[model samples]
Structures are given as C-alpha cells and as structure tokens.
Target: MKQGVQGSPGKPVAARVPAQARPAADGGPYRERDASVRGEHTHEERPGAGQRATVQRSSVRGQILDALRTALATGELKPGEVHSAPVLGERFGVSATPVREAMQQLALEGAVEVVPNRGFRVVERGARELAELAEVRALLEVPVMLRLARTVPAERWTELRPLAEETVRAAAMGCPAGYAESDRAFHRELLALSGNEQLVRIADDLHRRAQWPPVRHGRADLVADAAEHMALLDALAVGDLDVVRGLMGEHFAGTG
Candidate 1:
C-alpha cells in the first residue's frame, strides 16, 4: 500500500493516475527520451539497450517469483518437497537462471531454503506455526481496523465494495491461489486507509507468509471467509465498531 487512493481494485495505489493510464514502471518518458537520443547517437553512446535488457531480465524474475508464490499458496509446490530450479524452469518454459534467481528470492522470504548441492526445499510449516502467524496478523491488523472503523468515513468503506466482491468471485472459483491473492488485495486496500506505509508492508508480509502453509479449507470455508470481507465492509460503512470487531476476530480465526 502507498499514499494515494486508487479508483479500482488490482491497480497500483502509489499513483493518483489510473492503472491503464499510468506510465510503465521501467519505460515511460525516460524511454521516449532514450529513443530520441538513440536516433542522434552512436551505438557506443547508447546505454538504453543494456538498461532495457536488465529490465527485461528483472521482469522475468519477478514473473517467476509470482508464479512460485502462487504455487506455494495452492500447495502445487508442496511443503517438505524439494523443487529444483531446472525442473521448475522446465515447467515454466524458462531457463534455470531466472528460476534460480526467483528461488533465491523465495529463500530470502523464508518460503524455501537452499540445499547447496540440491535446489530449494519448501519449508514445512505445521499447524502451530500457521496459528501463530494468524494470531500475529490479527494483533497487527485488528486494532488498526478498529481505529479505521471509528475514524474513516462511511463512503470510503463503500468505495471498497468492488474489492470485496472480487474476493467473493475468487472464492467461488475454488482456486486457492486466486482467493489468497484477492483476500490479500482486499486487506491491503483496507489497511492502506491508515496511511501507514510500514504497517501496511509488514502486515502484508505476514499475510503472504500465512498463505504459504497449506490448509484444509474447502471451497465452502473459502466462500465463508470471503463473505466476511463483505460483512466487514458493511459494518465499516455503517460505523458499527462492535460488528466490525467481531467480524475481524472471526475473519482471522477462520484464516488460521
């Protein structure tokens, strides 16, 4: 989460500009300038090509990281399983270099551990660990949400209805990764209202970690969890602190 409010869900929140209208992260006015400079300069004077290559590699790494995270969330990359970069690369139709880089990132995130001669091993988080994560997340988010319920305008909560609906749609799809991503998106949007960047980042990290451990939640349970998002928005829109608090508790508890 960032400073400015976004008009829609799944859009970048840092910029006031709309998602489709926002400039590319790597290419924009700078890219246009580079193109103009390239037309007048020799090959030796052009650094844009190398910079663009670096950005392309970085983009591939990011895509691989996201796919790996989704796999972890869905239990496609099972806990206690060793996944080799080369094998994962084959599965993703890329080379081992980017896959290895992605796995290194996942290692830093505590989702996997490097095995030296082998590849990465998915960390086997048990029930207690998952519960502790949920508890900590609740501790971090519940109070903030309560505060928001008291101070945030009803219309602000109303504006988030689309995000809540997105979560419901994801849940109904019965795809764990889809639901997890949507659930996080909803929470991140809600928490961003506090205007605390560090809090939002920390809480989001916890939320992502909580999603890594596989759970036995069925589609029905997922739908119930998704329903709570709407219920929370409803309570917040009406400024019902009691209902908000109760829903928040149930939401975190159900997640664990």
Candidate 2:
C-alpha cells in the first residue's frame, strides 16, 4: 500500500494513496498541505470591455491548473507515480482534454513529466534541486523587494497586513491549500506594489512551487511563518532597508 501522506522517515517522500485517502483528525478530507487553498480564496475576474470568449477560456484554464496544483500539493497525486489524464479529469470535474493540456504546462514547469501512452508523472525533486530553486527565486525576488520596501510608501505596506494574517488563520485551521492561496495573495499583492507585472508573476510562481515547509510534527513553524509576513511589512513600515534586506534573505532561505 502507498503511504497516505508521508512515507518512512528514512526516505522523506510521499506516494499516491487510494482516492479515499483518509483525513486527519480534524475532519478535513486530506492531510493539511495544499489541502484546499485555491478553493478557499476566490478571485473575482470580470470579463473585459470585449473578448468574452477569450476570458472564459482563460478562466477555465485557470480552474484546471488550480485543481491540478492542489492535487499535487495535497499529495492526492504524488510524486514518482504516473497518473492518467482521465483520472484527474474526473477528480476535478473537467474533461480529459484540458487536464492533459494543463499537465503539459506542468511538464514545462518541471512539476511533472509526460509519460508516453501513460499520461504524466509528478516530478520528484530532491533537496539540491529545491535549494537551487530557492536560490533562483531569491535572486529574482530579493533585490526587487528591497527596492520596493524603501521606495514604496509605508502606508501601502500597511495595506498588506490583513492578507498576511489570513495566511496564519488558514494554516491554523489546517487548510494547506487555503494557506498557499492566501500566502500567494499576500506576496503577489505585496510585489504588485512594485508596479511590475512580470516580476509579480514570476515571484508568485516560485513561491507556489517553493511551498513553505509544512509543520512536520507541530504547528509552531506554521504560526511562525504567518507572523513572518507581518513582521516583513513592519520592517517596511519603518523604512528600514537593512532590516528589510535581512528579513527578505531569511524568508527566502526558509522556503527551501
């Protein structure tokens, strides 16, 4: 039998369980990792002045991608196991075509591998690769965030406090997916203050991929991580570039 969420401590890997992977003691459906983040944080996107069809297509794609990400995050579809497109299609209440397409996108992101005649396998990453990913994200994010911390008005940073707190609430509630989504919202909104769409999107992707290490055996780290977001804003509020720089470094380091 596949290990439900975690394998033996010696391996530190997760594998696929049956569709009915038992919930934790909290009555949640799955272990609280990416338990259900995207589903919790709803985004309101209105169709633009025109191009309704285009907007609809994008929205559908977004939903499929979110579902796939959740499955991967929650360990519903585990690393090193091949999963067929139709099975995922059924899980997300979508058609196989879109699931296949989304898996292809994940393949490009190094999150999965396309298996000829089989479908796709979640990509298993090692500690070295995770560290490398962290380095790349820090290199892309740290400099920009530092500049923004000093240049952006203090009041603007204050605006992001609630989102940070929301992350803690989600984590406390054992909603990994919710925490992931809110955490993304908090960071994306914070980065948006930089007025650079490309940077925001890039950092957002890295943050999602570099999920904050979960509470392996307790909730202390989860609460601590949530507080870190607020502390970061506090640093920015004081216009302390040195403190902001230090916080940014430590924050990025913790992701790996």
Candidate 3:
C-alpha cells in the first residue's frame, strides 16, 4: 500500500513526494488531464421512468470519478476496504478500463492505494496525521497568501470574491463530495492568481490530504468552514497582511 504523507502515530512515514504542476505552461512532468476537473458536465441524472436507464454525462470517466469521490465522502467507500475495478465498474455500470483509470488518478491524489492483486482501498488516516497535514498546508499556503494579499492589488482580491463565495455555496450543499471539489477549486484559483502553477500544485496535494474519513462531522461545521474562505477574501481586500495571516492560520488550525 502507498504510505501516508506524514503517517499516523505508528505508521511509517513515506518520503515526501514533490508536487507535479498540472498543465505546466511549458508542458512539464505534471499530467494536465483529470477527467473529473474537465468541467464537461454540470449535473448527472439517472435516467428511467418512461425511458431506459441511462448514465447521462459528458464524460463517462468523469462520472466515475465523481461517483468515487462521493462514495469516499459519504462512507459508501470505506477506508481500508479493498474493491476491485470489475466490481466497481459493475457498480457504476461501466467497463473496467475507466474504473481503473479513475482509480489510478485517485492513487496519485493520496486518497487510495493499489493492493497488489486485490484492488484499491482508501488510506485510513488518524486524527493526529490529519492535524499534521493541516499544519503543512498552513505552512505552505499562509505565507504565500499573506505575501500576495499585500502586493496583489485590492481589485484582484475583489475579483476572487466570487470564487470564495462559490466555496461557501459548496459547503452549504451539506455534502462532503461537492464541498471538497469546490473548496479545492476556490483555493486553487486563489493561489493561481500568483501565476505560479507549481505552488498551486503543491497546495493541491496538501488540500487533498486534508480531506479524509471525517469523524461524524456535520453540516454546521462545513458551513462555518466555507465561511472562512469568505473571511480570507475579506481580509485580503482589507489589505491587512496581519489579519490575512491570522485568518489563514486560524482557518487551518483545527480544519482537518
């Protein structure tokens, strides 16, 4: 199994993996393609009633990825439970190829592991490990955000308000899967304003690791967390570097 980023209390920590920038402007090592992030579809519908059951989506692979993410978030796909591509493909009513592809991408995201002949299992992370991850994210994201907040111009911060609000809406969705994706997008866009894809990619990995088996977390927590994004944006607009720093540090403190 692929090991955890920092590992839990007793688990062995793996060597830090460098973040690969997606779609590096010069076409670097990072693979630019992620089916789920393709923005190919807005909504998914399960067809039936008068018509035959059909999976309506712009990309079959994207749908599979979304389903897997939702399953992970909802505990439909529990951590440490191995599931084969064929079985998962049948569950999603698709061929094994797409399932395997989606699983491979998830593996890169530090969400799952390849279990030899056995299929894949979500990596189980402990509370301490998750807190460690939150610390790393704050270390990487906060300083850069504060630096940008000072020099990025107030108008730019104003422009990013929509993305921050988007995160709030996603959190208000009251579903882990939807909120996770939007939260990722909001942070990614916020970081991208720096014009550094590599930084954004590193933050992406940290963000992905922050989401794991939540222990009975509820909608109220999520809404409050989403509101934090707005708080960050507001602080940015206010041009208070110290406030931005404090907000960012506080946002990640107990986040995981």
Best by lDDT: 1
Report the alpha-carbon TM-score of model 2 versus the true structure. Answer: 0.71
Give, for candidate 1, the lowest lDDT window spanning 10 residues: 13-22
lDDT of 1 by residue, 120-227 (tens): 888988878888888999899989998998899899999999999998998898888889888989999999999999999999888878777657458888899999
lDDT preference between candidates 1 and 3, better one: 1
lDDT of 3 by residue, 159-242 (tens): 888877877787677877777778888889888988899999998888877776654257888888888888888888878888
81-126, model 2: which lDDT tens digit per residue?
7878666554544445556777888887667898899888777777
Computed on alpha carbons, the lDDT of every model, listed in order, comes to 0.74, 0.65, 0.68
Using all chains and alpha carbons, the TM-scores for the candidates as numbered come to 0.79, 0.71, 0.74
Better lDDT candidate (2, 3): 3
Selected candidate, larger TM-score, 2 vs 3: 3
Q: Rank the candidates by TM-score, best first.
A: 1, 3, 2
Q: Where in model 2 is the C-alpha error above 4 Å? A: 1-62, 90-94, 212-218
Distance from true location, Cα of 123 in model 3, Å: 0.7
How much is the lDDT of residue 34 in candidate 2? 38
- Clash number for candidate 1: 0
Question: What are the RMSD figures for all models against the true structure?
Answer: 10.5, 11.3, 13.2
119: Cα error in model 3, Å: 0.7
